[model samples]
Target: MTASDARRPVQLEIAVQDAAGARIAFEAGADRVELCQALAETGGLTPSAGAVEAVLAVAGRAERLAVLVRPRPGGYVYDADEIAVVAADVREVVRRGAGAVVVGALDAAGGIDTEALSRWIDAAAGAEVVFHRAIDTLSAPVDAIDQLVALGIRRVLTSGGATRSIDGLGTVEALVRGSAGRVQIMPGGGVRVEDVPAFVSSGADAVHLSARRSSGDTAPSGPGGGASGFDVTDGAIVAAARAALDEATSGS
Candidate 1:
């Protein structure tokens, strides 16, 4: 690593589904927050306009927040109409004070959708563009890093093509080395506080996690009797992760 890069502290990014989660993340000392909606149901999807406004209010700075632009919960392969919707959502979120937009799309061949990516970049109108975990779906994700860099993407959130970031540490390290400071490689997906040191030692620019805990009524009710309770960001988890990252990167 370059001398300057070695001195750069690792960032801690928390994924949140609402304003309240944003507040928790902020208070926990998060470097940035990725705001979304329906995280429990769909992993994450584009939040409503009001949701964006609320999160921005708590973030206090646009660059402290990034909003996911996924139009649906399903696969990243999008139809024309879905692409149009994504474009509109990107513009809307950016206009609403999102400093960065997390987005990804795949072609039928299971590769990055350059066309859709270009459209989203244009719609962002200067806001940072982040390529989400869709890169993990590729057979050779390391090779795709260069493609993303060429596309002017500022960052990429990934689990190194594995279900959990910890299990994919080797691949994550390769991705970090392969990026060569061109694009930020953030290890995400099932990342735990215990895993922070490993990722930090890998030279990752940042680490991302939902850090959520569930609450609410578990009594049988509603259509499927599914738990009526919901998940919220756990401040304790965020704070623990923050401490771990700081400890790991200390004197590096």
Candidate 2:
């Protein structure tokens, strides 16, 4: 087989905050799901042990599941105590049947915290490890990519230092080229249906998205115009993304 032909097929990974969302994403053809909590507020937090078990129970045999291991949100930098919490959470999720754990940690200088990250990686217990979007916050992403590859990270999810992958296409493409197949660069953040083909064309081996939509389950307004209920994953959106990825890869 040709070198390119022998490469693994592109994949679509959906980030879902709960079991209901997990079911929708899976049924709609998601190849993998990153299970987490408080997506609206924290981007994503480490899901409870029970939550991880419940999502895995409903996943299909073909669908892989990864759990985010952030103890809390806000930032990727963590103190020693926080690092301990992250390590504990990673072990808990793996024990609960997660096939992989999504994690990242930055030092005070805004670079990959290799020391802190090592603890979580060791806690993964042989499961796949994906460095999360904290890569985007790095002062030098290319340099960080080298570090992660050396550390044996399977993939790095990033928007190429932009708020959206489409806006960062050039950087993402550069990252793909720079990795030289040593690591997979998965573009994420505000990925839309129309953007999938472009991302695939840019050499992203995989893509991540939330596929979230308003479920019309609003909460009562408390005080002054506060945030409403959680947005659920839309099966239609997930299906469309899957179809888009299929079309992109098939046409290539």
Candidate 3:
């Protein structure tokens, strides 16, 4: 571990889909909120301008807001026209008051699409940038992390190229050691409240989780099954995760 890792405070970043979930996450002690839409359908699609505005309205002074800039749901790879769309979305989110933006892209070679990523970062207008989990799709995540750092990305949300952080703890640890404070390695993907302490102990500077639970209500049959009743952020789960992180960091 680097000397700085000993002093870095652990952060909890929550993913929320709408104004209601954003408010819940903030109130429950989330340090940052990743705002997106269609999380249930799309892994997380770019929220509308109005949704971004609403989330910003509810964000606390100390809370950081990051909007997801994915133009589509199928893949991280995008063409020139799609890159243009992502650039425009970055501008819109920053102008609407997001403090950061989460984005990612891949080349046909299954590597970081530096050209596309650069354009999105440029369009952020100085907002903090986070390379999203698409990094997991790369053949070499450790190398990709270095490239992202060279690009001035502040953080990268990943699960160590696995389906879950816990399943890839070794890779996550290597990333932490490899980073040596150059970039923040945030463990995400199926990170549960029970997993916070282990993630903290594993050298994650911060952790990202949705803390989501289904509403348990079924919608009538319709297009896309009438929206699947949507999953919302669970404030209690967020609170528990925060407490766990505090305990782990304090003890360390």
Candidate 4:
């Protein structure tokens, strides 16, 4: 960051929906926490106003908290009812004083829904707006960049529409370049400490991950239908992510 990059050390935000998870991201040195209810479902809107307040009350300044604003989980394209629901969710989330709101919408053709996005952005007037990974789902990555830039999104959290960020290097690289300085191109999903450099090299301002590998005692508490493949984000994973950023900074 050079101590003057505006946002230093390449912010490492973690996804934590519960208090226990909040503590993990906070103690492990995550810069921001994207609060949600169903982490396994790629997260939805914040569970409650009280939930957002609780996290802010105890989380550190480095640990900013944000709430997701999806009415329900499905494809990026939302029906009119879902859009209204998400708009309402945005207003509520902002009133609760979240650091940011993560939301996205796609057209029927899998492109950025500028109209729906504007509604979400308008409802979240004071909050930072993150165009969630729905961007990766777009039919055209380059075109999506233009749409997001035109919409003045605060950040675009994408994995290049691939299962993981690393796998979409080429698309991600193009996005970073096309975006230039219009919006922050944040490569997330399956982002690991080891691959942090590539993302940075691809010009990402930040990275996202659950940052947990094992659930430990929380193992039985799974979030999937099969009851297996639980997503476990832990302190160690966050620590490793931090280390990766350090290495990248040192240019090692």
Candidate 5:
């Protein structure tokens, strides 16, 4: 067979949070993992030394670990202090050997701050860049895509700026076409085991989601527990997502 036939497609990366979660996903066959803290908060950034170290220990097996680089969950725009924090964060994460960096910045009208983003991408020093769902906040996603392309971002994680990807298929498809090999379009948000097919059918270059199971039908004890908007990820969910990926790849 030709070398091209042996080569796989770009990547099938899954967003994940912890070392245990990463191990489960890697074992279940996820190609890569995005390390973050408050996945409930749309997968906010975590630059903790211990967490980064934990993730790095598994870097040998994981396809990659792209750490989310936001200082807060409120918005993409950042004050001077937050920017400094993110700057320092880039240095530390790269020093810790993260495989990629997921981040973004936007103006009040929701347009991407190409300058701010470019600065971070440079600060990241050649590590892959995944513009997070902040793309969802933009008033005109197409415009944002064009802007990001000019900035030379690696990929964008978005659900077509909607509540979930299924609701934004048309726009997502348009984005995939608009990207036209310039960058990757990774769909995310509200993606579950059963809904993965819908994302595949929509022409996503790749998919992203939080996959996990509850301890029980019973809820958690309180706010510090499951009541939080972003529940922690689980190995079972990662396995299911892998199964879905296998089905999608095999055309089942």
Candidate 6:
């Protein structure tokens, strides 16, 4: 870590699905909000331009807005058409006043798809570009950090090759040591409020989570008429995470 980075407090980035979530994150004192759609269904696909505008309106002059640019809900690998669609989406989102764009693409060999990344970066038109958790799908996540840094990626959100950031603490720490302040390393995916301290101590630049709670309102659906609830950003959880991050990074 650089001297400046060391003195800076760890950041909290919340993955939000809508304007309400963005408002909650802002009110809870989060450093940034990653806006996406179908978060509960598809692990976060790209949100609509209207959605981005609404969130930006809510974000206003406070929170930083980073829009997720995943074109579809499957793996990171994408065909030419999908890549083009992703690039277009990136352009649209950046045009809509997003401060950053979150994206990920992998080659069939399970490595970074530099080709697709270049297109998306070009489409970003100098807006901050963040590599999402798809880095965890690589065999050499630590090594991929070097590649992303080389590609001018501003930050990478990863779980250190594990499904949960807590389980991947070792790899996360290793990535931090290897980053050398060139690119930001953020541990995300299954991050809980109680795990904030451990991540803060890992020397990560930031921590990402979806401090979400189900809105217990059920709807009458076909087939399986089970009581299904939708997920929303929980203000209480965001506050707790903000407090935990503050307490953990206090003595720095």
Worst 10 residues of 5 by lDDT: 1-10
Question: Tens-digit lDDT track for model 5 on 190-245?
Answer: 77777666666555667787675543445455866645233455767777877776
Which regions of candidate 6 are displaced past 4 Å? 1-7, 61-63, 221-227
Q: How well is each residue in 97-185 modelled by candidate 3, as lDDT tens digits? A: 89989999999888899999889889998888999999888777887767888898998889888888789888888888888889988
lDDT of 1 by residue, 111-224 (tens): 899999999999999999999999888999999988898888999999988889899899999999899999999999999999998888888999999999986647565786
* Cα error of candidate 2 at position 94, Å: 0.7
RMSD each, Å: 1.9, 2.6, 2.1, 3.5, 4.0, 2.5
lDDT of candidate 4 over 98-167, digit per residue (tens): 7688888888876678899899888987678888888776668777777777777888888887888899
- 5 or 6, which is superior by lDDT? 6
- Report residue 14 deviation for candidate 4 (angstroms): 0.6
In order of lDDT, best first, we have: 1, 6, 3, 2, 4, 5
TM-score for each prediction? 0.95, 0.93, 0.93, 0.87, 0.85, 0.93
- Top-lDDT candidate index: 1
| Model 4 stretches astray by more than 4 angstroms | 1-8, 41-45, 60-63, 214-232
Off by over 4 Å in 2: 1-8, 61-63, 221-226
Q: Global lDDT for candidate 1? A: 0.91
lDDT of each: 0.91, 0.85, 0.86, 0.77, 0.73, 0.89
Candidate 6 structure lDDT: 0.89
Error of 3 at 48 (Å): 0.7
Candidate 1: the clashing residue pairs are none
Q: What lDDT tens digits, residue by residue, belong to model 6 across residues 36-73?
A: 98887889999988899999998884238999999889
User: Which 10 residues in a row give candidate 4 its minimum summed lDDT?
Assistant: 1-10
Least accurate stretch of 10 residues (summed lDDT) in model 3?
1-10
